[model samples]
Target: MAVFGTNETKVMLPRNIADGMIKETRTLSTIAKLSAREPQRFGETEYITFNDFPKAEFVEEGAQKASTTGGFGSVKSKPHKAQVTMRFNEEVQWASEDYQLSILSQLGDAGQVALARALDLGAYHRINPLTGSVITGWDNYVTATTKSVEIATADADADLRAAVGLLLNQPTSWGVNGVAIDPKFAWSLSNLQTKNADGSPSGVQRYPNLGFGTDITSILGINAAQGNTVSGTPEAADTKVRAIVGDFQNGIRWGIQRELPVELIRFGDPDGQGDLKRNNQIALRLEVVYGWYVFADRFSKIVDAV
Candidate 1:
């Protein structure tokens, strides 16, 4: 007997498509490129954080060694699902093999981009890209850290330097090795100019290497990535977060689950639009789980004056 209902069931995406999506996500997401990552499963994954490191002490001969302890803590990375669904013409199903592959590739591209954006939005701003709302219960870097630098309209260089200074001056001495900056903030840096002896703008660019583009790889000798997600759209008109500077190797960690499911639905309205069957459209839904944790006092955010 032919099982027609089974044909509409969801299935795991091909390994090639899934791997390509992950590669594109890492390429597009600034945080993903800078932060430490690990393989995450469906459940919680825990990583240890050191509050203090025990030091070796010089002991006198015949003297008893005193007991020493180091402060250690753990942070659990809880799985958060991010999904993207798109509708396409049903005619794609009857297309040639090459044409079908092209359509699938395009769908994969959209899914990767959405996943990248969601990572930035959730990790940096705690915003959910799907609902355009703040995700409760999880504190993003902006809300979780107290260290911050306010940008002055007159001195963009000072703003960046101040942000780095905050990290270096911390009691634990955080390093400023990587920076994820917003597009608007990058523009500010590129337009910065030195002043002449008479207080006039010296035509020379203060940071000549810092340009306003998506391909920015470095800023002032520090690794950098530019994306609008750095300063995500908040629900309210609050202080705009411009950049995050920190020890990317140790300050934050994130990961995505390997299994990615892509489903094809030819009936019903999955997106609240008209029915797909009635409209002669089919929907492709891609889902993947992601997790992240930001260490306390390890990062400093730069924001415009409130």
Candidate 2:
């Protein structure tokens, strides 16, 4: 007797996506609005802006072309990373403007979708997936208990010299590598504020362009303060960098945005003056290089001075 009864209830699995209809909506455009505090898309200017209003621009890093005798033997320079500039319209008249438009910023949800999901995304900065210590000098983590020493002035030979000694005293493994500062901080003291070591007061200071969640606790809190003490008074008012000397030396230098090889930090005032409201209408602006992580706005470029 040959019993050949088939098992009708064999367990099966979910079918593949043959229906041609995607169920999930994976994009940033679905959202209506994007704000800074809750960033989703950086509104405006793109390689193709006619499609997306506000328009985004993409600039390339300086390039060096090298000819060689091989298949496509032309060595091209590294294209810079991505960036954007949001011009905060200060005119209170335009109620739709964002007064505190940050020069560099992350994208909002809608913008992210347009560039990522819709467009053919390539060599553009999406988002930093990896999160680590904000300051990346020492190859370790800087705790909240470290002490921060402020130069309180400009970049002086004395301040740099002092920094060397101070960092040497930190607990061995606390990202205690050589110190880093805002390129502006480095320049402010070195060129503009350069003072004679013979008679001039120590006129240089290294501003804090550091990587931290908040506050310079680990640095300022260090009991055996050596090189890393938070220098100049870091304070602000009326939503602007109030102290120019301290601003350049410390405040502006320690912006939330961190960069490499150079960090261009700008300090502005309403009446077109600096900290003490120096008239002449001179808005302090310059490039800070040789530091790290600094990049251009809407341009894929990194300016680093050896």
Candidate 3:
């Protein structure tokens, strides 16, 4: 005899659904791989922590040893709760196996898309926030007064060079040096011209080999990417940050306190008359507990205008 009951189904569903949802979420979210990610243990509480020490310097063999002060440092990120819920009509509970399978697949796909966008937007805001209103001053914003760079002007190459130079000039080594630019600026870059020493047209194209299809993969020997979310409005003249260049892996820290989990509640709908008749719809909740931190301001440089 086969053993199957409500108790067994509930236990199995959460485990299987959580696994499938995590896989789907990763596939749909570019931010997962674009930045650094740290997984938290189950039921762990409090904030995630990161520590870094200074590099050792040479000292005389018999001389007093040099103390690497300020080398020992730490930062923390408090995990925030994020959730999505999908409700299925009571009829789905009794529907055919094929019908049930179809609905579940659709729900999973939609949920993943929603979660991915949320994460991408969160990273965007931190990497490029409003000029004077930066949330935590974590964004490495650049301006004419600060770094002498313009975002929406004809001289885009100069701005890019400035941002890239900042990252390269940092004292630390970078694991992944790349840049994320607004699509509009990227389009502007594609039209850049190479001028002659005499101020005449050199007939040489700056970004002659740049491609805008799907995504801008590379530029000027560095990994280049384009996304409109990097700024609020690419056309706005405000202090909108237009582009960023640096070691994203060492800059952005993403933390997860709990893996995504799917839970179902049959008695969640008290408004429906079916609740009293034991035929109410099922309430599906998808949850993810995560947080993010931008460490080392020098790891990222932003191009903006004031």
Largest lDDT belongs to which candidate?
1
lDDT of 3 at 249: 64
Q: Which stretches in model 1 have alpha-carbon errors above 4 Å?
A: 1-8, 60-63, 140-143, 212-214, 233-239
Q: Give one digit per residue, the lDDT tens place, for model 2 in 1-306.
A: 111112221111112211110111122211111101111122221121122223334546775544432232211112213222122322322232232121111112222322221111111111211211122222211112133334444434345444434444534312221222333433443353334767574544333432321221122222111111111111111111110111111111111111211122223452232432232221211111111111111111111222
Q: Looking at candidate 1, what is the lDDT of residue 242?
A: 86
Q: Model 3 over residues 87-115: C-alpha lDDT tens digits?
A: 66756666676676666666667776666
Instruction: Point out where model 3 deviates above 4 Å.
Output: 1-30, 42-70, 126-149, 168-176, 193-205, 232-239, 266-282, 299-306
Cα lDDT of candidate 2 equals 0.22
Greater TM-score among 1 and 3 belongs to 1
Model 2: residues >4 Å from true position, as ranges?
1-145, 153-157, 170-179, 192-306
Best by TM-score: 1
Clashing pairs in 3: none
TM-score of every model? 0.89, 0.20, 0.68
Model 1 per-residue lDDT tens digits across residues 63-89: 999877677788887777888888999
RMSD (Cα, Å) for all candidates, in order, is: 3.0, 25.8, 6.4
